[model samples]
Target: MKNMKISRRKMLIRSACLTIGSLFIPISYATAVNGNRHLSKGLDLIHKVLSRPLDVSISHLNKCLSSGKIDLENHEGFKDYINSLITVFNGHHHGEDEILFPTFEEKIKGADFSKLKKQHKEIHPIAEKIKDKINVTDPSFDNYEEIRNLLQKMNDLWIEHRDEEEGIVELDMEPLISSKEQIELNDKLSKHGRDMSEPANLILPFLIYNLEGSDRDTFTDDMPWILKNFVVPIIWKSKWEKMKPFLLA
Candidate 1:
């Protein structure tokens, strides 16, 4: 009877220690011990995929143009840059019109979604004219006269449109679209945890290329999460391969 009681007590004590150890063990270790894949492990990949790099690209282009200090030779690869920019801008505007604006218009009956739509119609033609000009001036051909005129006009018009849309239309539609809240929810859905790699990749490269001295430092410091996981595994080593002759000129 004494021997059986002692054995039972030993068994109970061992079970209690196992339970206590499990309670104190970290979730990551427990997952590893069980040979289970952690669902939370790949959150960084999703964040990198969903993160928007276009805005930073656009801002860098604008800064380069404004400063008149762009190394055009290095950026020859960006022969498609202007067109890409316009396409992206138009698409974003269209998204706001189709998805964001309608819902907003319903809530704010007095809001001028139509007016904004009309403004797009007015702005797009001017942009189209400029794009048409820019498209023709390829690598071999520098139709400096027509290109310069259109570019200057487009820049002025774009700034005005950006101000009106970003300041007036976007400001008013905040409540209806709830863009801030939606963006936050989307960010959370993008990743279970914040990614630390992006700040060193896309954002830093863009800033370093475009900005200099204090301005560059400020941008980098302020936006540390711009390119969380943008490691370029493949490199385009040949510069000559990237360059193409403009036969149109």
Candidate 2:
């Protein structure tokens, strides 16, 4: 009976996770920090702007590279395309490492900001190496195999870096981000629309899921602006409409 109960609970939990994940907008959990909520929204907005298009473009380029069906000269057209995505990605990480992370570390001492910063240092060189490899070079160095290897390395490094930043290091913002600070940050972030929105949507969901009873209520109630204006419409509802098929698949 105990085993059956555990199995049933696991199934129910999986169902809940799927339901929540499919909805698009992140639900408010207790322990949701207003400032972190704001930051999450900003991050999600920025990520959507950077990732989706880059993934599509890279997929096409990778396929062409594999088949030898596309000319390297044609890859030149995608230079700007690739660069645009890289610029936004770098800018987002730069803001986190330089602006957001420092502020939080200063406010809440004893947190392992150094470790996160170190990850940034390690990940950036890999990113730069990929960028260098992708740039059109001399014919003597030409080899599709080398390019393929670079792409694999770049992709692997990127996935690992994201997991570390988003997972390994738990950013305890409860002590740092006061309600007042969140409002101030929101006011400042109003300038960048799409760039800000991508990151917000991406992180907010994860943040919401992590929060518990009271913290969750406080975070959501205090930041109704997110639900009414941003989260509900621009993110969750929009995602539900668009991403439902993918989720079901």
Candidate 3:
């Protein structure tokens, strides 16, 4: 994580003034700092921000919706979450298409960049439709079927696309790139996500809540000291109070 560009010290300094919201009431759910689940480890420098975070999001979303948890009480928070999820997913791909893929196309010999690009093209409309549906649909006993279907479709497409992409990245791409190069790529991609997160409150909570076990450790460990240590416990609930009801962690 040496080259993760947003150094902990820098982030701490940048984020210091944002603690005004820290005084609000904290959430009741116990912190997941000592997480229960195990993370599939690769290189945390990349996968922590890219692969596993998205994977956690997809799985949690599927589980929450499929387990019959969607309801009127959570309708607003859930909608907020869907938007945040899409923002992160869309931003990641934007970074890839704009920054990462071009690098891979130039660097990795015979890389089938088109296949991934094609899948992205297919997934975009589905995600866009999901957002539209989520925004309009109020959950009732029978009204949410289409939203569920769209979410499932979105999750499935993402699963298929990301699995294929991760294999290529870890096997074909990792060997060709230097550690420094990987960090540079990770930083740019992370910046893109940071730039895209709206309502900012939801982004950090989304990231922390989605991660678990050693994966959580790696993310928190790498976070600027102020964010993971102070913001999460003291500031998170106040900032994300609206979405807390529907959040997984």
lDDT of 2 at 109: 67
Local accuracy of candidate 3 as per-residue lDDT tens digits, 136-211:
6555433366666666677677778867877777667767776656656655655555555555566667656655
The prediction achieving the highest lDDT against the true structure is: 3
Off by more than 4 A, model 2: 1-36, 72-74, 137-147, 167-171, 174-176, 183-249
Per-residue C-alpha lDDT of model 2 across residues 1-249, encoded as one tens digit per residue: 999999999778545544443333322111234334655544433444444544555575567666766545545434433443444455456656655666666776665667667766765675566566566643213444455555555566656665555443334563357666755644433322223323343334333423345544444454456353454344454323332211211
lDDT agreement of model 1 with the native: 0.38
* Local distance difference test values of all predictions, in order: 0.38, 0.47, 0.59
Please provide, for model 1 over 35-127, each residue's C-alpha lDDT reduced to its tens digit, 9 standing for 90 to 100. Answer: 221112211111121122233334545555566555356345444444433443454345556544565566667766676677667767765
- The candidate that wins on TM-score is 3
Alpha-carbon deviation at 73 in model 3, angstroms: 1.4
Worst 10 residues of 2 by lDDT: 240-249
lDDT of 1 at 241: 24
| Better model by lDDT: candidate 1 vs candidate 2 | 2
